[model samples]
Target: MNSYSIPRFTMVLAGVLMGCLAMAAPDQPPVSAEKADERAGALLAKMTTEQKLELISGHNQFFIKGFPELGIPQLYMSDATQGVHIRPQLSNQLEKSVAFPAPIALAASWNPDLAYAYAKAVGEECRAGDVAVLLGPGMNIYRVSQCGRNFEYFGEDPYLIARMVERYVRGMQDTGTMATLKHFVANNTDHRRRTSNSIVDERTLHEIYLPGFKAGIDAGALAVMTSYNQVNGEWAGQSRAVITDLLRGQLGFKGLVMSDWTSVWDAEKIIKSGQDLEMPGKANIVKDAARLLAEGKVAMADVDRMARSILRTCIALGLHDRPVKDERFLAKFADHESVALQSAREGVVLLKNNGVLPLAPKGTGKILATGTFMEKLPRGGGSADVLGYNAVLLKQAIAETYGERVTFVAEPTDEQLKAADVVLLSTGTLDKEGADRPFALAKADEARVQRAVSLNPRTVVIVNSGGGIQMTDWNEQAAAVVYGWYPGQVGNRALVEVIAGLTNPSGRLPITIERRFKDSPGYGYVPAGEDVGKGLKRGEEMAKPVYPIEYKEGVFVGYRWYEAKKIAPLYAFGAGLSYTTYAYGQPVIAKANAKRGEAVTVTCTVHNTGKVAGAEVVQLYVRPAKAPVPRPEKELKGFAKIPLAPGEVKTVTFTLNPRDFAYWDVARHDWSVAPGRYQVLVGGASDRIAGEASVTLE
Candidate 1:
């Protein structure tokens, strides 16, 4: 049958079905999941097979069709992580929106409350713009610094990423917008993303790749978007093991699972694997599914399941009861800009500092700012990019703060640098969605920094990038180095404020800054030739074959590998410098001995010994006294960011359960905590521990 005749036949079938389900159910206000399920089931009973098929597929690039005959409205979604993406088509409706700092910068803040507020602002904009679903808070782990989409995700540590992601989900969902936890499972690489398979073990997948999604699920996220990559040997969109077994059965996610734009390999397989929707409906996924159904390859029950899930999500989000109109929501939240500024302020990590920092605004002489990034801020590319609403450039911000004192120069001569009291060198690396970035600075940028530092002793370099960059060439010569990870719209304002001593830098390094690219675990593992099952076999004459990105490092990613291998990085994980000084006290455990599954409270006192008020992130690392299997020297377990006034002390406490110290045991097929003496270290950074305490688990 042609597409035109199919819709007419389904309309008649839908009328008959609606009559059968005409018995009205009790109405409930403030829609709950129970009510949503009931409403969804009623709607499902009334939808014909053709109508259900259309409802499950995209109506357009960014919308899913709804049954207008049953009073259901089409669901409108927007591509958002940093902020609501303003596409050319959406420019008329959404002229401008707040592009807050990237997710990586938010993660650097190490404050979940701030992450919640950040996402809340984004969600508010979604509502104002009539966008029901905001596809954001991409929780994929930052496995490699080179990954183009790294800026769109949280940091490398799963625990940290999970914590931030949960709050992000809560913040967005609370504002009546459905938050989508995207790029599900082992989507770490952008190179060969569509064809390459991620060969990861079950334990590694559960430990490293799945925690962030699990945290979002526990936080009640209503939507999950599948990744473009393949997990194991099957495409993520068509893998029943990943979609059905892991997400639905193990994690207990009851939300709509949609495919990435045109990412589906087989329409029938996606439906059978529990994937609910196919994006860009132009992919003819619905048409193909219909053909499969006619051939007895796809079941009507599968179609009904898909339609019901979408309805449930819509009703639960209150989308069904509301009017579908362009709200033209003005992105006019000054308060949100304040929140964005605060987030940017907290996320600015001081990698290096001498006495040259906190430049006194009163008598500071000419500040020569040189770099391409000074005038035009360097931001990640692709859909994550948003034309920010009134974004302040670094040069503009510096000039605003220190009128007539800051000079912008693309290339500074030795005479120009020598004449300046201080040289502010701005440099950055750019990464986006389609490709990974080269892990080092360009030769010209390195030359600029080296020349500036040599010409003037008091030179401060500001490095802006998605993740880490090779800073070995000129880091030693600079007086200070600050890592500003893709600061959003008002990031320039925050940057100037931090440099001028208005705000103290408190953000820590979320990922390890390797001294060189070759030192990384994934470095040199790229596919070169044909695979020999165990590994690849390089050959001069061979056909290019699809390669697999093996997770050989397993749980030993980021700091874990560096510590275990004893390869010192340029900057350690959880490493951040504050202008003020902090003193750490010995960790005191509530109980020296505890039985299995019992919670242990660990407390430590942090004193601000410096002259200024500042915040310190108290990090907690755990290591087993003895274990059967080899493990990293330590792993981050808990952390708390404490704001302290000069001469003030605060006792920060953390509770740890069995799971906190547990490892993913492959043999047991579950998390296992070996009972033995465990050392708990507390400090300002991961490698710079100041105090330690031991606990015995019986």
Candidate 2:
């Protein structure tokens, strides 16, 4: 982050009078809904039925069909959960891109403003590729620790995920590039994702799962991509209950709804379900839709709706009028890399520190770098693996930071371990799309880590993972522990800076790290699978569940389950330490009593009590002192990130709405707040509460 500087105002009043005027005049304001519909309608009228059908499907693997004769530009799309996964050019050369930290990493930062900056940079990358729609900002709630796709999403809390998703959607669309909120609803685990059915209750769906999607839609996301799995016995892409009723009706999303590649089953059902687009250009959609319409299996009105959805989005976003491709941003990616570096700096969680971090400046001693990802920039496999341009590996960063003092060793002997001043064990396993990562590190990694920890207590272990991993094996013996989630491209530089004391670690754990995998709510819930459907895509398809994978834990995911069941985890949600310390003063409630639909304000003062300047993430947890129904101990309602110099204190204020205190009423089919006493807890993490106050809600 220090390597890049923020752009300053250019005293543009001198030149911007002409430049700004030119820009302001040429670019028309965003068309209203009525205007967008009229424009789309005019274009739709010019196209034939075949052309309309083509508009609803992809032309190439990542492009939408466009008519050059009609002056429409073919729009490209890309997989962009982490960064722009730039497609290969016609020459088959991969396009270079700046890789930002994973979504979970950004979520860990707990800075919505940073989330906006992180996403805006990525949106710029989308423009560089001329990608009209970015198949990203996947906000599915993290359900299991072993979920492979967790890195692509925010953590397990609905409120936290919603806040991040809202910012990300706004940031991407604000760049004039469309953002797609993806894997709509309950896409927790990637294992058997194509076939597994997530059996979630209505209340759990609304309370724990739907908030993130709703936030994205409310933020003006232009598109949504359907999940590959089934929900309540029907494929999510072809479920009217999920698409038409839940997404469009309840969430009020009127965007283009596209299915995951090869995810659609019955064309007739998809047409009726409001799946506006089938991706990767499937032939069955065109061929079967003709017959379905002729046989009255599908309505012409629904088909028109689907095609109109695509056209409306294109017209509304001005994608139909402008060239989708622009290489201008590629030259400016150094600025984006700095954003990635800043995200990594803010997201690296100092899990444990026994005065071993920020090791004695220049006298830190011979740094021993070892791990599976020592030489490679670890990333989630599949689409999230954006080949980072100028990505710094852990070893590379360590060497760059420490110079001649750094040494590379896969396995150090007892003598070597004893000889080194510090053992920097940079360890993590690569995550794949369809496979679930183990809750524990690999046996070989465990042994090496344990050996290093046992021999050299100065061992500073850096773990790169999507979520929690088995740390109990040797974490206690290690002098310090850091959870550096997939830091993108130049993100390793930030990690090194934190270790070098140049940057104070401020990230909090987005998800809880359980002491044991079995201690999780989803433990022993692995579905046994068999391929029942013919022509299932790949060999991995055999893992598809024949029976529904029940979410018996319901709304109690992550810290909620731990707090509710009284099972202690290795680390709590929102848990992370910093080089400096912070003290939270007693919270002041603006009002002792509150009614429905009113905002209640809470303020707390925080002081940087330590010697170093650092940032503190002030967390606000809302709890019902007495409730009529079952709920978790506390839920995250509001939060703020405050930076202070040593001895400096700042007061942070948070506003709470009725929805933050309400729970989904299953019987009433609406959110309801039972009249009760509520406690407001403010602190750094869920378990690290420092101050509390009470409020009455009637």
Candidate 3:
């Protein structure tokens, strides 16, 4: 019997309910699990290979037009991450829902509460549209810039990404909308993504690329989307290591795996590897699988197992429930302005400040606002970029905060710069094409900043961007500078708080900013299409010279790379400052000898001696005093954000597990803790280690 023509939604629902009930059993052995699968497979095995093939090839025509299948209705799938991107034209309008902020902005907030709030609102919007499965919360690593879909990603670090992904998934699931954690495995970039192989080693793949998805899975994400890119050498859609070995075997992901939109390359391979569904297309992997079964090349049990897997996912997401026709989804949709505002405040980093910040006088000094970012705002771009919502620009933020007395000027003239007591110049590149582009702050803008600095000498410039920038030209010229990535609607208000000294900027730079492009780890490893070809220009590339972006500084990424090279950056990672001063006492470890699995605590006293209230991030780093393999000066193990008023003294403590200090020993295929004395440094950023203590792991 054809797998495509199997009892459709009716039997799928029955299978799902049975599977759920069976899953409740605790003492189930592997043989029992396989036997249960075989039993489920038996039902599918009775159908003709052609019938089974039809069910797999096309969904019901009611939901997906043109794919007719025995009068059965297709399951309604919708697009949603923060919210649904419904087709703008109503005729093709599949969903009508309230959209939320992109994930990248959410990651900056570092607040799970905001992530849940945003997701709940999006889920409400989804429910109204009768969308059963939401296609997103795209959690691919921001490996490179050419990935046209980076706006959907969270950030660079694995821990930060994990936090955001878990919250987002929980939010969507809470609203009864199935959240799909997507682009499974190492599907990092979009350049040649469908076929390009991500040649990442095992350690990088496990630690960095897979953790967020692991977190989402543990949080009960219903589905996973296999990416277009290949991992190691096999396509993620078909790679057993990615789909079976890692996602299912290691992470224990019980959810169904689906392909990206038309991302399927091999039907039988994907089906065998455990990809449950091929998205938005009628390419029949199930039918092909059924044929293989009838031909005796593959067992009928295999086809049954695949069908049962798809049925289980549909059941788990509760897709079997019939839709109720109503517009009630609108009421569930919330604007969620508070969450957006909170994210912006926490996301903005105070990179450089000298006594000039927190504006000495209220409603003070003629602030000459200059920079293109003020007028032509820089928004997170690409497939996930939202066009209709309200946003707060720096100019608007300053004006609202300082009131009518503030003077606003765009692209300030040299004379205008001299007349101002304090100049606020908003500068930085608008990140597009996934990562930072070739032009890091145009020379013209740099000259404008140079001229402004020469005139006022009290100029304060703010960098607006998602990633880092080349600050070599303007760092010396500016009195203070802030890094504000694409802050959402309440960005203006947050900036005002930091400026007024009401909210001390405590955001750590998620990624490092190099003084020049030459300083980046993957500076030379860029794809041929991304290369400017030394003034050859965009869209005029010649095939002859394949200038691969040289990744000379391998594994020395972020501050670790720059620190090891002793190359100074304009600002370091975990770098932020406040109006008040913080003094750190000598660090002391809680235990002298700690075991591998146990956590070691470090304590330090921080005193706010200055006359202003401020917030500080007490970063804890651990370095092996002696080790065989090379290591950075230190690796960030843990951190705590503490707020203190003037004259306030508080003890900030950070706890670390031995695994935090361990490195992946690929040779042993396990995380190894080198037996040695380790130094614990507690301070601000990587460069400012103020307090130190030593501990031993036994």
Tens digit of lDDT per residue, candidate 1, span 68-123?
88978877888787888877764345667787888899899998877777787778
List the global CA lDDT of all models.
0.81, 0.82, 0.64
Clashing pairs counted in every model: 0, 2, 28
Q: Per-residue lDDT for 1-698 in model 3, tens only? A: 00000011111123212221222222212223354445445545555555555544435421322122332235556664655666555344533343344566566555554566667666766677666667878887655433445557776666667767887787777667778888786665544445456667766666567778988887778788887666767777777778888788878887667777656657667667866666655665743665666677666555555556655455444443345223575554334444445556666777777657766335556777777677655655654454435655667777776775568876567788898878878776655432335536677877777788778888887876656667777688678888776665556666667766666665666556678766655555555455431322223322233222222343445676788888887777777776667999999888898877778888899998877665666778778898777666777676666767778999987778766788767788777889878999888777889989898888
**Could you say which candidate leads in TM-score?**
2
Clashing residue pairs found in predicted model 1: none
Deviating ranges (above 4 Å) for candidate 2 = 1-29, 89-94, 528-545
The TM-score measured for candidate 2 stands at 0.94
When 1 and 2 are scored with TM-score, the better candidate is 2
Worst 10 residues of 3 by lDDT: 1-10
TM-score of every candidate relative to the true structure: 0.92, 0.94, 0.81
Position 547, candidate 2: lDDT: 52
Error of 3 at 130 (Å): 4.2
Model 3 residue 373 lDDT score: 79
